[model samples]
Target: MALLWWEIFIVVFFVLAVLLPAAVIAFKPQWVFFSRGAKKSNAETINLVRTFMTHYSLPLGMDPLHRQLCLAFMDPFVKTVYSLFAILPDPWMVAICRAVDAFPGNTLRYILHAIIGRTHLIDHVVTEGIKRAGLGRCQWVLLGAGYDNRTYRMAPLRQAYQVATFEVDQEPLQQDKLRRLRKCAAVPPSAYEDVKYVTCNFNTERVQDVLLSANYQPGKRTIFLLEGVSMYLTKEGFAQTLAAIKELCPDDCTLTFDYVDERVINAYNGRTDIVDPPTPPLGSPRSVESTTLDEGMSDCEEGAMVVDKKTAASKKEEVASRASTPLTAEERRYGVQYCSVLERNQTPVTFGLDPSRLETQMAEHGYEIVQHWSPDELAQQFLKWPGGKESKHGGEIVSRACTYFYYCTVRPVRGSAV
Candidate 1:
């Protein structure tokens, strides 16, 4: 009995030794800081996997050579992880990829390809813009730049254009990233020269003040790379950030960012799994139901509105009933599952824009769209699979259906439009 108990204890100890750290990392993004600490995010992990995939996929003659070079500039840990996977056999890799929830089997190929493609497209556009306008006179600003190594990798552009990358996030996360960077052997001392690290919550921070403090010149022609950040912010926060950019950046300064479509946010058109809703303005009435939009006009008039004077669930309900469309059986299932997952993760996606309203929406914030690409457009242009007709079309269909990612470039509209 004593020997059997000892064996069980040893087995339990080993199990925890392997599982505890993995669980911590897997659930890091959902963790609340008690004493101010940085936890891993889904975005960070996606970046790592994407970079690793890029390194592997490059030799396959799938992606552009320059993109492969860019991957070489990634964080040391990312590179190390990629190197480990690169040495692994295809069977082993497929098994590991299959085990991941986000990317199952060969689906990872399309996902990684799309990510790398979008990244390459952005880099090409920005670099070409810089080259055209004279590199030595330009400035590059990567907003919400998390673990992105573009500044360090673009040797020619950085040497000439004088890049200044700013990463704004919670202090704890910023500290953790900087700490990692310091420990990275792949990064050199000179890599620090062109980049400036700024720590602030973008939703609350004054962009003008933050930029000025970071030695950013508002007058200089700048290229703002706002990648993978919009969905994380509320609508007001998104608008405020854009307004700050407009007020602070030069008229010609270009801004590029990706956003999820409003349809996806609302989980419309069979996309019931996406959890998102447009964030209403400040002082907006709170809803008992979080997903529904309060679109009804108030009879109380603007300033005369009283706070609890309206336990008026009836009025709100009437308005919602009038304005809200009924959901289908499929949609209801998708919504329930999506919301359940969202609540479990403790992260609510509260911002999305209708693509049809893109031009008007951007113009409202003093920005005019220069170019845009949908998921289908991106896939048709960039995705290439190895097999025959059936495989290619199937992959493209999967990629096209993924309308969550979009790329758009905009410039500050001058004159009365602002």
Candidate 2:
């Protein structure tokens, strides 16, 4: 029987995920995937990709192949196209591998980095952060973890027999993933004895209750990874989530996650094509001749002619005026406000939790910043592609203009846990 369009698309995607990185490693390793000076060799790239795929193919009470195929196919193409357009600054391939999961293909759940690069970036960061925490033997929690393979892939965690890992998400999604995993990999029960899955709704469910039900103890030192999830939540939700972590885990626990600055969120909101005018305004409707002229212009000139701030703002206001119901007072408050609502009444306001503000918040929450890496600094460290100088338009410039922050923090404010 012939397959459906989406099924064909998914299969083709998996093929590419396996093939593209392999091709890059075999033929154009340096140019296609890595920055100019990255130390990773062709052999390392091939091995890493293969290792990730092998582990990803495993069944840990979840079916991930379908989701993996979807991600393997969609993420790289989207990220590469965006990078080619200079709309994305970070390495697109890395972002895709790090953030894309096998369940819930909702584009809204992932951050810009996730959307434009390989999802493995999160995996890499988390592995590094785990090592930095020096908690090789502690329990680890992967909050909102969707098809995360760290428990299987990371060597340290695999070797630490005493360590336990908890993977949490909404129950329905988790069940769907579990079903898929069972069908695809059929992992032996013994292999997953130390890893547990928990289902909880971050907005309505109590974290403590969920952990206790999953056999997680409040007194154990834990490491938590909350990646590519905060932006989807309201501010209240994020704070409550954090507070729950503090309350549930022992003092020596550590949490790592990423957050976007308000400016970045606003920029993303402004760039969404959903609000684009259906037709040019009556006054500016173009004639055939004008349309021809506009189409004939050089790429540079056409790019330059694209809407500026004033024009964009005017267009937004026009769209707002045309809508039957204008943006709510709540909606107009920016994405952060929406996030604030999710945390319930406990709103911890920081400037995207900038270093200074993060320090203050950590103190109040009985946590301290053990490690912090600014997006700008990370871009500088990882994104080695220098911008094209000869291009008249500045679009080719690889600016470290990221508006997100990633950090790792330890709990209990000052003392080590037994």
Candidate 3:
């Protein structure tokens, strides 16, 4: 049988996305972190690619950014190619997005599992929040904004962007993004006139203080998008930031963030008790015989071959159970390797929370859940389910990091607004 295009694409994706990075981390521990496509921090680069998909014809609808930001972030040559796509009419761009989306077990869904889910969840929150609070009276903040261009897209100069938009991130990252924006020929110097950037280190200064310094008013409804930041933060750092959100506004704010289960944190910390199936490295053989079956297991196999029909049927059932249950171990391996990559880069994951205890944890911080999406829900809601055996193999390789992850939008329990 010949390989399909999607299958070939998957192979390439695994090599560039998985194996290459793993080799780097394994050989170059305690070194700088980056992939072949990276220019700055690996986190920002990856998030930029992921969130940039908001322009694609996603099921939740497209949230487009300025074309120059998109082009400026890419390599000079890649930016030229991206510009070709960016310059296309909306219908053509939509067609291109749909084409990529239709590929079976598409790379977009597998790689973007939790991200797409987070996008959908936050869009809902924003739309609803705008309705209730009125757009002009609300604030929108992107915490740890790393290459995020939402503020740029929603700046009042671009449209009737009534809500105040603020972006908060580390100083170096914000500086780099600003540099790129100013240097891009397609973007005007005044492109960032409307968005306020808050350069912050959450460990020392509180979020409320920094946002206030940036002219973020308290008591009005706010939507804080804390994306892909918690796991990198220490538990104490995460809690302190959460407390700041509470202090910023009461009852009226919507906070969206995601976290991994403690087992993921355990994996990062080199705990062995997780007991995931021993998945082989990408492209490695599935199994190898240590001893000739003819020498040792031949007699057992020959003996078992004479089993009654009932016994053979029982064996078949066991194999079937392996497929439908326990989900997969490959994703778990991906999750572990991801942690390994960051850990080697000296930015190990330190904070995680069990999804079941999410509401409880938020309650302790004076918040209540508005919506929560587990990994299973995210897969079903965002990615395409497998149709048959072929896609089942790809689906089995669904990123385990996504499985451990959980997303939610929560609101304060009481009004601190008055």
Worst 10 residues of 1 by lDDT: 290-299
Number of the top-ranking candidate, with lDDT as the measure = 3
Off by over 4 Å in 2: 1-136, 186-194, 266-356, 382-402, 405-410, 415-418
Task: Assess each prediction's global lDDT (C-alpha) against the native.
Answer: 0.54, 0.45, 0.57
Runs with alpha carbons beyond 4 Å of true place in candidate 3 = 1-40, 51-68, 75-109, 156-161, 185-191, 272-328, 383-401, 415-418
**Highest TM-score among the candidates is held by which one?**
3
Task: Rank candidates by TM-score, best first.
Answer: 3, 1, 2
> Which regions of candidate 1 fall more than 4 Å away from where they truly are?
1-39, 59-86, 89-111, 268-343, 385-401
Against the true structure, what is each candidate's TM-score?
0.64, 0.49, 0.64
Tens digit of per-residue lDDT, candidate 3, span 154-192:
454323537787889888778888887887776555557
| Model 2 TM-score, 2 decimals | 0.49
Question: In order, how many clashes per candidate?
Answer: 0, 31, 1
User: Candidate 3: which pairs clash?
Assistant: 331-400
lDDT of 2 by residue, 1-418 (tens): 3568889987787556544543443332234423323222221222233223322212211134323432332224333532332322224433343443211231212222322222343455455444544444457788887655456545345444456778888776556545544544434344444578899877788787898898987866676777656655666677778788877864556576766544334433454533322433556632211011122222221111233446444433332232212233332343343344223323222224333244555566665554444443344333333234564422231223222334333344445322
- Candidate 1 at 315: error in angstroms? 44
